[model samples]
Target chain A: EDQVTQSPEALRLQEGESSSLNCSYTVSGLRGLFWYRQDPGKGPEFLFTLYSAGEEKEKERLKATLTKKESFLHITAPKPEDSATYLCAVQGMGKTSYDKVIFGPGTSLSVIP
Target chain B: GAGVSQSPSNKVTEKGKDVELRCDPISGHTALYWYRQSLGQGLEFLIYFQGNSAPDKSGLPSDRFSAERTGGSVSTLTIQRTQQEDSAVYLCASSQRGVRGSNQPQHFGDGTRLSIL
Candidate 1:
């Protein structure tokens, strides 16, 4: 079965502290790997999409890198405003899973000042 | 342009009551999807629509859940005899094209929070 898993379910980091969130997946064949940010009381917002291993995408202080078995979301000098639940999702190219993206449980990061 | 829109930002009701949630996808988006997010859980895919047709309903938890799209723009998800377990944030999303390797990312709405007592 196709599955996505994220580690460090909850992380508390001081302001300006850098950290990395992990998203590991097992699938038949990967079509895309997506990263999303979700704040409390709201839906998730798109961040980046990585199509293959060794690919990378960045936005502001966030960078996403992909590998054959996992993806990493690295936060650099995060601010209080950057605190939110980071979500990772993967889409498989198989017949039973091609139409939907399987999402991970998410990592809740708290950047305290 | 408006992203996706959903009605009744919050709903509170008793068990066994039927409820309806609505979604309006992006003006030109041909694909729509519905998902459920329980407290602390990941977003769960509930259904998918291509225009006015639903090609997948396997994600729905029970027979009491049903959804339909009209005019290829507005969609509704109806749940009958709602239970406490049905309470969750219902999210609606849309993409430019089909989800199968289309590389079209989904845009989401704020979502409707349902609380069944």
Candidate 2:
């Protein structure tokens, strides 16, 4: 089975504070690792997809990097608007031909002004 | 031009009642997925459909939950004899293709918040 674990279940930071969220996973074969941001009452928005180790992707104030067993989402100078839940998921090897993805509990981020 | 869309943005129904949630995927997307999210939680994959093929219902919690995609465009998820545990937000997402390892990003809808009273 594919399992994902996220750290610091909840994080509180003041505006301009920087922090990093961790996502570790164990699966048969890691096809892809995805990072999403979900706000209250809305669906998750895709952030980045890291496929291999030592790979990195950045968007605005957020940067996502992946290793062999885990991935990191670093937030730089967070703002109040960045308050949301950060989710990590992994696409696992399939038995037949179909692919299945598993998600973590997520990191709830709160940036206060 | 339009993103994925879902119907009944919010629903409140008594226990044992049946509810149907609708989802319309992006115009030409071939893969559609249904997921459930509880309060302060991450997404729980429920089902996935690739074109008109048999849907992968492995993630479905129970037999009471079922979904169908029609005309290769719209999809519906039905819950029978709903329980309080069923109250959560249902989300729908669509991607372009799944075959040959494509980097298709799943575009999601706003989601339907169901409250079982």
Give the best candidate by TM-score: 1
Q: For every candidate structure, what is the RMSD over all alpha carbons to the true structure, in angstroms?
A: 1.6, 1.5
List of clashing residue pairs for candidate 2: none
Q: Judge candidate 1 against the unseen true structure and give its global Cα lDDT, from 0 to 1.
A: 0.91
All candidates' lDDT scores?
0.91, 0.90
Candidate 2 per-residue lDDT over residues B1-117, each given as its tens digit? 499999999999999999999999999998889999988877899998987778899899999999999988999999999999999999999888544374366778999999999
> How well does each candidate reproduce the native contacts, as fnat?
0.61, 0.58
How well does chain A score by TM in each candidate?
A: 0.98, 0.96
Tens digits of lDDT, candidate 2, A1-111? 788999989999999999999999998777889898988878888999888899999999999999999999999999999999999988867665356677899999999
The TM-score obtained by model 1 is 0.96
Worst 10 residues of 1 chain B by lDDT: B96-105
Candidate 2 DockQ category?
A: medium
